[model samples]
Target: MEAKKAVRDQIISNHDIAEKFRLLADLLEIKGEASYKIAAYRKAADSIDHTPEPLSTLRQQGKLETIPGVGKAIAQKIEDLLDTGTFELLEEVTSEYPPTLRELLQVPDLGPKRVKLLWGELKVGSLDALELAIEDGRIYKVKGLGPKAIERIIEGLKSLKGRDIRIPIGKARELGKRIVQQLLEKTDKVEKIELAGSIRRFRETAGDIDIVAASEHPEDIIDTFCSLPMVQDVNMKGENRCRVMIEGGIQVDLICLPAQHWGTLLLHFTGSRDHNLHLRDLALERGAHMSEYGFKKNEQLITFSTEEEVYKFLGIQYVPPEMREDRGEIELSLIHQLPKVIRQKDIRGDLHMHSTWSDGKCSIRDMALAARSLGYEYICITDHSQSLGIARGLTPERIVEQRKEIESLNKELAPFKILQGIEMEVLSDGSMDLPEEVLRDLDLVIASVHSGLRQGREKVTSRALAAIRHPLVDILAHPTGRIIGSREGGDFDLETIFREAARTGTILEVDGDPNRLDLRDVNAQEAVDSGCLISISSDAHSIEGLYNMEYGVGTAARGWIRPQDVINTRPLDEMLKLLKRNRS
Candidate 1:
């Protein structure tokens, strides 16, 4: 919060309003009430996130209304928030929703309509009341609240109240390490650079990343940093401060402090926002400003050079960044130890990719290039089979032709390995898209159901079981085929499928596409408990899609799956050995 630093108040950009609008849309949608209104907000918000020119500049040019998703109403609201820090419409709707009620919407089972029902008929407005209703059988007493819905609600509440969204500490370390590598290549002013947050301690997914740097020459650092090709925007920049967007769209704040204060700066920015806020409150009790910069006690800025120093000033042990999300880690770490998360370097391969043989915009070679650029040792090209004809599925004969193309590409990729895998269809009869003859010929085959989701659990499980038992089905892609809210691919009974998957050594996929983050954390952990190996594969259909694997990797960690649980982390020879062994 330095004077030279960019403040949110000074930001005339539509990014802030746009972000809030989308979050509002999510809240409205999950509440399952006023969907069109939710859609309108979301459309407006998405346009802002994707805007080529900053809204700040655009408004001055008087062209905000010209954007496709931005109509006059949304444009006017954007202008209002840009000029002032409030949205009248959002405020009005939110006033009807108290904090506790808002939190309930996140549980997934109870959206806005249910919230209204609880508020109107059941006279319940908060989680506490809702819990009471369920315990008292009042929930089921309400109309449309069936036994199954009640059960789902109870479990959803448990999930909501429990410690949610954990990542493998190791994977966090990998991303942090890679960021350090990128930093080294891009900036000479980085006399020191290290992953300073949850990633440093190895968590599954990082809420945010902190890059600590010490350099006598910060101007050189800023110059090199903003000039780096991947530096998408300068969220903040100064001789002593800089932040930029890196690959995979992650925001990295590189703080240039006096080498002596490097540790303190690292601690401040490396914090969980919630944790820091709590610490700030604690500091207020002690008459201090506890911030990412330092603890400003009494009007004077008392600075620390290290995280340890800052923690000492706050009268606490240096809680690692991963545990700083205010999830009781500040108190827990004092009593016992915590589990380590996985890092990206531990990832050995990129699985669940696509080629021109399917819906992928890229050919096999193009996908390989993008994967290799990420330093992956191997890539799986799992194109769609003929049964999914709409996805330009490959016929059995064409798959043979693809094999020939793969062999030629394999030769060109001297050291790197590219596995020829097929995303085969799980036919309605519980048979695979390719016959045993064709399936056995490949290194890996991921069987998935593209249709028949409406058949519900029993038939879905039967089809999945058929695929799992198939000698050649090495992995199951996007188990449950969940398309956000619109489609549920087979409405699979995951526990049953996972139980079968472990016995057959078939991997369950965590499809990386944001649209299909299937094998979701809850189901993924079940698969883990069932002793099923999982693949956090980017069901990437093109070269651009290869990067989506990071999202899958993050989701995998949130489920607490270590690098070992994911087959894609195995080296080329070992991964191939396992799949080929399964085929035999």
Candidate 2:
């Protein structure tokens, strides 16, 4: 148990150290430091972020510099962090500049350069100070400050003030996974540990994390959980349950029960509250009282170790956690007709991803190898078209060049195919960036709107419709270009677009990028109902990004999507046939 705690502690420490370095980089940039120095710290932070092994282990083995982007100096800094939890350089930097000034950077449009200007000239060290400066018109005197910039700053401040406190589901899962792994390793008498609540259901955002464990020694389990290094505040301590606010200010509740009552407790706690209520009503129809402990039938209590058994006792088929939202699962479960929800394993390939031909960090062959590693039979290299120059979008000549490269690589990587494709941008006037001649030569085309998002609904809808109706286009990438908590998606009639997509055999992407899970759960559900085929794609730029397919599958499951509803669930030949059908 002690050893397990040490591992968990090490993971937390590594993340903390990386975050501090990142903050220091931002601070250094604000201090007008050399660009190379800022890049060095940022690179070190990125290396630490991507390293799978614990920093402590790497330090012990003297292999910290083996991590990509980590050099001798950065490796030494990591060692110093592990040893003293602080370093002299970071201390020296923070001493000169109050770290609170970094908070101003969180305001949108306020980069390090602007922050440095404000802090140096007007002594604006915090959001409140900036707000005062803006209100008093003193901010206008700063060079490059104008009416439009002031308006944007005010808007950013308003957004920060009203920002949602809930954490994204992906982040919640990562935290919950770490905690569950530690508990599984450290607890002696534990039989099972499962995450419950909205997190298990794969909601887009979660209020807190709930964990249920089956153990013979409940007291010991509670004690170990409360003692975890991440626990910042213990709100409640009891025999069977303990509630703690973790390091990130997210609350987590741990419930320990005997193995016999594990299933009922998990089901009860893993609920969309309304779904549980509906289940209880169904139990009442059978003259049974349902609760977390068990179901009471005529003065006799029945407890089950498996969720399937509990569902059988209720005279219904088992409902998947993601489908436990009270949208319609109860009615389907009652009739034993619940849809076979799509699982991560059902995915055969990723249809939308970037490569070095555009903005991606990895090369075409490297991306292909990474996809193959994930058991994918194929992947599409959907690099941006020439309109998105910031992403190094491919010109027509470059597209032809990339196609030849893919063809050569495809011959070498035989069974694993790399489908030539482009994420062609739809211009404001409803025209695609790439010409028909170039698009016709590709195996797949993902038509997307990358600019002019502020157009009216009619303009946006017409633009999107043109792309959907294009013969060469296969999928609509991020039908709505939303970044959760950052920006709202473009205003277009989604239902109208869904209808056209269905008619044209065009697929709408359920993009897997955590920042842009566009055609989000609700929108995905609507598209499915409209008979539009959906593609759950990662839009991966790096190898690590490929794993984001799991998050996409979770979103699809939340939308009640079945395996058959997702086009990528089909094998290579079938997917190609469908793509061809769309073209036809």
Candidate 3:
């Protein structure tokens, strides 16, 4: 029970961390100032709890600095928390408001700005104060807070008794697409509309909808948007941009640009801010002015009618939204240029997937047919092996049957190649689920440790190396299995895993599952540095999950993976040759 309580406490603390960062980040974004830096902190805090080493343990060991993205300032605060029982930065921030204000900020529909509004404008700092202030009818009169918004705020406050569904990026995109379609129907002035930022790049999770539209009449666009069924409250109204709070407490930004400004608007709103900033600086250096209106050289404005023109004027061939993160792309893009974006057609096959034979919701035949229909040249049906009983792992008998089914399916669909495979479990003893004979027969093998996750560093390194060095293993999937907002897996020396994987001609998978975008961007870069051939797989359990593969691709590109570096980008014949050549 004590252990349970400690776990509960830890979970609560993590919740606070995620909530504060998100709330603060949103407030900073809405205020439209220093957002990228605040967003970096929020993104860093978002990833920390997913890290295996307790931020506490790392801080205690004076190694919080080792975590990617944490940096010295955050690390020092983490260290302070380890030495004391509280986080100094959080404590200091909360001190400016009331402690309860921090808790109140967690309520849906409320943000740091709202709390700041309540504190500064209304002299209401805490929930109790807000309640009293609301009862007395004072909060409704603030500059940004009005009656309808306040009423919705209180409704959200009351609804906190129930849980709201936090949606995935794909689902949010579907909803946003629906909204775009509706607006398009309402006006022919709607020249272009697309999701920008991380959603456009297919991030797993998302905060809000960023909708940009190029139009003839901006007022009609705003009217069409506010006319949408999702909008519950219009927070701010401007000719160019409008912030509307939607149902489920999700915020959506509708930016309407004159058709002439569409290119600049898209380029600006589609920003990975670091990338935009560097581009802005570059425009300055080249005696060009860069703005949402487009790039200008000298005193004259050079606006693009399309995003392509914007990039050309900036002298970058074009930087795809996925590659925007200011991670040294500017320097490379300046030297020799590649195509601005990766097309869906470029992917030759879906390399990592499960079937009904394992945890997947579909059959091998169904998945293969679906992939073929989607223009894939090949599909590998990799079921989990016996060690993962929960996934209905294939026993040796099942493995034989599975191969027969694949072979039969291949015969039926003669043109499309089928790779018989297993997401084999690498047991704690460093033995594989399928013995040597079964592994040799397989076209591809992925060995992953799903259990014994508590084994410390050396054991994890050994298990990973054992999997990589084994003659049959081809790729290691979700090596860490660290789920976002959940328990973390043990630590392995990633440097060692990459070195071993490289030497063994094994690939390391960057899992695309939103909940488990394992071997995250930083680790993927580390793998690249180690000369490991990287593969981005959805680790797809469902057909819908397969679509999330682009998230892995996006994360990979952010880590600077070129087309030549990813294995699945290979055509069927070449991929087969590579696999067979590396077959041990």
**By lDDT: ranked, best first:** 2, 3, 1
- Backbone collision count in every prediction? 28, 0, 0
Better of 2 and 3 by TM-score: 2
Task: Output the better candidate (1/3) by lDDT.
Answer: 3
Top-lDDT candidate index:
2
Best by TM-score: 2
TM-score of each: 0.55, 0.90, 0.69
Model 3 residue runs over 4 Å out of place are 1-175, 185-188, 201-207, 296-301, 337-343, 580-584
Clashes of 2: 0
Error of 3 at 62 (Å): 64
Count backbone overlaps in model 3. 0
The lDDT for every candidate, in the order shown, is 0.71, 0.87, 0.74
Q: Is candidate 2 or candidate 3 better by lDDT?
A: 2
Global CA lDDT computed for model 2: 0.87
Off by over 4 Å in 1: 1-290, 295-337, 485-490, 580-584
After TM-score superposition, what is the CA distance of residue 261 in candidate 2 from its true location, in Å?
1.3
Ranking by TM-score: 2, 3, 1
